[model samples]
Target: MAPKVLFVLTSHNKLGNLDKPTGWYLPELAHPYHVLHGKTDITVASPKGGEAPLDPASVDAAKDAVSVAFLANHEAVWKTTRKLADFKGKAADFDALFYVGGHGPMFDLVDSATSQQLIREFWEAGKVVSAVCHAPAVFYDARLSDGSLLVEGKEVTAFTNAEEEQAGLTDVVPFLPEDALNKASGGKFVKGEELWAEKVVVSGRLITGQNPASATAVGEAIAKALGV
Candidate 1:
């Protein structure tokens, strides 16, 4: 059977009060889905079974021909979203795992015990575990059973504070991914060119993309890791 990849999404967010958008960014999820689902077999899963949130701010990015066309082709994302509970197998069953990012993740994903357990299982199984943008903050609360840092020595990149500042959402988002990763990883953070450019880091079995622009590149890296 072909190796399968899972796109784990964050579903919950601060309900009411804030006017800010929530959920996975369209480009971050769509680009990787387009690349992986088209190139090889994959599954999309989220914390909540259905109704994955879509950040309203990302709608502009999805206005392009490629993105619009891609959405038009993905009826599953439109109709039958999968839930994480449905998967009965262990993390070893997957070839790779991806965590899609948006402002919403900072509200829920970083503190998820279930997500941390699943990540440790996947990483220990040698699966290609990847994340983009704000999603990398999810690792802040994740730790090995031995009490060692999960990403202590890994070279990874996520949404930088500079990018958050550039977008004028520095305060709108709960926390900055770059700062969290730097502190969580004990100052082992790394980076590439501009925040908008496609930059990804790969260390052994772990893969990370700097921002949403790096989604496609991250997917391709996962594909290569799976030897697909």
Candidate 2:
């Protein structure tokens, strides 16, 4: 049987108090969905559930074919996402857990006790754990069995501080994902030479991608780790 993957998306949609709209990056979810859809069974979940919001900036159909295709089938996929709080599935039921990111996860998943538990459960169960871009924020409070952070001593990557500066939302976001990961994990945070360059780091079963451009690569890494 193919491995089942749980995809966690952010339900929060606002960029701090700026009133600017923000949610999961479309390509972050779309590209991975396309890459892993055939290899594994996927179920989308979110803090608030329902239809998870999408970052307006990531909706350019002209440039993102996978995202465009995902939107075209939004009714079948996006509309059916389950609420994380309500998901009855156990960690052992799935082979891996993936977190899709945008500025939204920094606000919600970062401090979500439920999310932390899920991550811990999945990791302790020996399931693959992965995140990309701002999704790495989910690891801010996720602790391992040893009480250390799951990212601690593990090679990882996420939305870099420089990338946040480039996006000019360094101040707008509640906290920098890279900074949180660094402080929480006390591990080396890696980045690519240029902003948005595809970079995926795999340390054991933990996988991370630097930015939106690294989404597909992250998916591929996760697939390989799962031996799919």
* C-alpha TM-score for every candidate: 0.91, 0.95
Segments of candidate 1 deviating more than 4 angstroms: 13-17, 85-89
How would you encode candidate 1's per-residue C-alpha lDDT over 33-108 as one tens digit per residue? 7777756677777777677777767777667555677667765673456877665347867788789888777877
Q: Top model by lDDT, which number?
A: 2
RMSD of each: 2.0, 1.5
lDDT of 2 by residue, 1-228 (tens): 989999998988899989789888888988888889989999889988788888887785326777788878755566668889764339989999999988889888888988988999899999999999999878877897788888887777899999999889999988888888888667677888888789998989999999989999999999999898
| Local accuracy by lDDT, each model | 0.77, 0.86
User: Clashes in each model (backbone N, CA, C under 3 Å)?
Assistant: 0, 0
Stretches of candidate 2 off by over 4 Å are none
Model 1 clash pairs are none
